[model samples]
Target: MDSAVDGLVSQAARGLHLRVAQLISEVEQRLRCEVPALWEYPDARTSEYIAEHIGTILNGLEDGTRLGAIDPPAPEPGRTGQLAQYGIPVGAVLRAFRLGQGVILDRMLEEIPRRTNDPELVGAAARKLIEGANAYVDRISERGVVAFQEERDRRMQRRLSMVQEAGVRIGTTLDITRTAQELADLAAEYFADIVTVDLLDSELRRDGAPAEDPLLLRRVARRSVSEEPSASVAPQQLHTYPKGARPYRALITGQPSLHLLDMPDEPVRGSIPESEAGALRVHSMLVVPLSARGATLGVAQFFRCGASLQFNDDDLLLAQEIAARAAVAVDNARRYTHARATALALQRSLLPRRVPPQSAVDVACRYLPAGARSGVGGDWYDVIPLSGARVALVVGDVVGHGIRAAATMGRLRTAVRTLADIDLPPDELLTRLDDVVLRLSAEASIDTDGEAVEDAGTEGDIGATCLYAVYDPISHRCTLARAGHVLPSVVTRDGTVDLLDLPAGPPLGLGGLPFEAAEVELPEGSLLALYTDGLLEARDHDIDAGVARLRDALARPAASLDATCETVLDAMLPERPDDDVALLLARTRALGARQVATWDLNAEPAAVAGARSNVSEQLSIWGLEEFGFTAELVVSELVTNAIRYGRPPIRLRLIHDRTLMCEVSDASSTTPHQRRARVFEEGGRGLLLVAQLTRHWGTRHARRGKTVWAELGESVAFPQLALALPGWDSG
Candidate 1:
């Protein structure tokens, strides 16, 4: 069939064969310069391979073989493989082949007029070349499609793996900004040239209200794979965008957006200013909502510019998947932040805002709760102004942390204050506080059947430790006691720091243990440091090392009490203490001898008149004539009671400080009782008479016997002394 035509084709093919190298070179040069898609493979080796393939097609045509009989070149190895390696799509690779085919036919057709004068021969050669080249390009392009699809699938799998990895990395911390930054970084690394994450202001606030439309979005994290700066300003500093902006719209609609980021006619607007867009060289963008649990937390934006491909539906899907996971993480972080803030507030309220002004001691205190990870704990300190210008310095730590422990600490502090008001000794005060804790723990325990029970070792157990010290300015002495507490540190006037060798009683909740009081004569200007275990033990250091460090800090040259407290804390505590810390620093002071006056009385009623006259004269000499009468009457009654009820060695003393004090000491251990005597009774009213003339009166026992003391506020300024003469006999 058409044998003579085939021979004519063969003759023309032989002539074209001589110029095959010329045609191949022309096609290769055209592909290199004209086809932008093939520019990725600019290497000379790739160009040579493409050119040789064109030569194969021309050789098949010259052999006079029928189009079907001329087998298509067994898929040229790695010709399109280069395109797959560079992530060039199958369409781009095929377009390059089409361009090469055009170049070959055009160059050959131009040669037709020179090869033969006949128009018929010229048209016949053009037909043979076109048919062969078309078949050759189709086969090569088909193979390129399979390779490109495989490359796309592999890339998709890789991206999926990246998304899964990101899910693990993001929200690893319960911090909102950090989680958002993780999402942005991962997106820029795997998906886009530029990525920015914006969360709703309400979500960040965790205000528990529905997020409003055109939600106020805050850009928390942004990243750019390109070397260029993302914008003139950082994304975090950009803050909020207008209502109709692209990111806002995503939040309002809870739908993702795919469009040109900087397009003039694009529905997305106002998020990025035109100036910022130009700086970023933004061409295409995908804005996806970060939504989870039926609420939209934020929006994530990805930008592709320059040679990067435009955003497609597939890219939008991937961004949405990643955003979905990140949104949940962000929401969780927000909730935790809110809860932590609440706990922090509760803790602050439970702790003392300011220590009470202590007259006997210049006091400064610090209370620091654990960081967010460990939560607020039960550290507490108080400066209580006890009666008679004495102060009780107390520090306590409830075991465990959080709201319950803080509440327990508050209750214990209250108990200590109540016991202190009764003038109980330090050891006795702590002993009562322990009983209070044990009783509270028992009350907190309720069985499953709704019956009250004791859970001494379980959740109801309130494990706590405390240090209590009563500092008496009058005596210049501090009585220290501990309930499983760290011993107090004493910094002497000479700048020598030493931990008190006080006995460590069992912790407060452990009842029945005797708490021993350690009495020390604290010199005026000496420092007393009382603290909870947190000040002597933390995650980074043991109790012993912390105490040593604290000692060193205290041993420094004398500074102000406040400064000394600050130095000790800075030296012993870490940046973020894992345990709650509390410290109380006090400098002791005492009344000078000029501020005090004393008188010794006989163990007889005859001594009372002289004792009263002596105290009255002392008050007059001290410029406290205003307190003369109250002082004389207090001295008379106290001296009378000491002589009548007490054994021997009766003594009366007067001290003028912020208040006027009258103390009567006797060898007898009997404490005088104040009584409201009946009209018929002239006796049993001596102590009562003293109480009426003073602010307060109380009895404190000593080793020898006891001291009954009465105090009058100097400002009371009672009338002048009047000697009460009773039943005088006439001579």
Candidate 2:
């Protein structure tokens, strides 16, 4: 190109650089009108950026650089990226740059005509100046567009990452509080400066749908970037929002909304305290309803505090999506909590309320339900008073969890008590219980009409384990039998603990397996520990370790059976057991020779007189003289029937404990039944009269013999004994 045109263009560019401040002012004014988006930016920032671009262009022109070789300014790309981050359109940025270039190019072209009189030189300089300015704008605009696109892509990627992170982080557990806190923490990290999760009080309690208009909410969780306590509400605080409030409106409509707190008409000021409203006036808030499965569970509030960008449509949609997932999780946790609570209530109701008072053993028991996740299982313990100064210690566990297991446990416990009333041996009793379980399992497989259900899964296939033990103080022996249950531990009076060497029978419900009973002769004050397997298979330890711990605990000297029970549980169980646990501890008490009297008699009609004489003497000695007539009549009738209808040897025994007890043992397995006698009949009145004269009368059949026993009333108190046998009447 000609030096004259280049020199004139360079001189004009130099003169314009000297007037750069005025040029920048003119560019800023023109941009405010031509590119309205730049008005959102600060006036000083706009002026400074324009001045930088103009100065760079003029410096290149003054250095005699070629028109096509002018480079874009250093700050142009970064400035465009900042504008894109603030959500400004790229078109507006380029338009503002184009308009600023027009002002600079117009000034340089107008100055060139005055510096040179030659028409060709003036025209050439003006053309070169206009071409360089256009090249500069084109290059800078390209850089700005690239930066804007890159910023937009980065923002989109960050938002996608946040959504993916939310999917993984929230709802990680079946706990409502934990899930709520996760939602709050995630939102506070990615979307907002302050996040609060507020659930409807009714939803939290699983108490059906929420009320209309004004809603009562409990703040389950809250998180803030500043980590300071909220001025409006604290965590777990229950507060009510009026009808027009943002949270209330969002829940009522089941829609998400964005609100600018600086708006004078915003209703947030009515819901929060004046101090908090003042502090929040400069921020933006988003209220998203937590709706799932057609029900609105609660609302999540996200606040952009201080200089943070205001919440937009995209932020509202993202918050709504996150709240939707969290709502489902909260609902699941609420349902689980309700189910566990119901199962626990049913289990506690089915268990024994209080141990009965018996002469055989001093018993104490403990029952614990499973942890939160496992729900309530079916573990039960009971101390039932049996006939003839004996007591039954029962601990059983049903498979599965929730209401079905608890109900089945109740039925099994009832079956046990019913079978025990007949004075069945432990092995025979378990056999009967096994049959009952088999019947239950069969019934579960079929419907009421007896048709087999095709979809009946293992839900109805009932399975359980039980340990039944009957201890007799008179014999000082404990007969124990198990149906797929853990062995019972016996702690001797000398603090020696050993698990009973009982046969391991198949668990109940698996029919056709015979259970065997093991007899352990326990001395007076010996401790018998019967428990469900849960005690030996807790979460933290294996069965072997649990057994060792249990043995060690039982071997330690304790003040009483109650203390021993507590000690055993504390040693064996963790804070939150994975399964239900039931422990029964019984200390044996023997009836000494003074508390009982016995005699053998001939199997003849005259034996009745000897039995009556012996019983009267025993009652008199035991200070139960008031019951002498009743005892004499009961003994006479029982002995007479045994000699008349029973075969072979017969013996009579009188227990002076609790109440006056008359017992007749015969070497016959035939059980006597009570019948109403005809008015004119002289025979068959023996057993009927015995039943009428005693408080309770029953016949317990043994392998080789049967005992017909009768107990007198408790109206006459014995000095040293308290005997109240169960009412297991054969009649």
Best by TM-score: 2
TM per candidate: 0.72, 0.84
Tens digits of per-residue lDDT for model 2 on 557-591? 87877888888888887888888888888889999
Clashing pairs for model 1 are: none
For candidate 1, the TM-score is: 0.72
Full-model lDDT, candidate 2? 0.81
Give all candidate RMSDs, comma-separated: 8.2, 5.6
- Model-by-model lDDT, in order? 0.75, 0.81
Model 2 earns a TM-score of 0.84
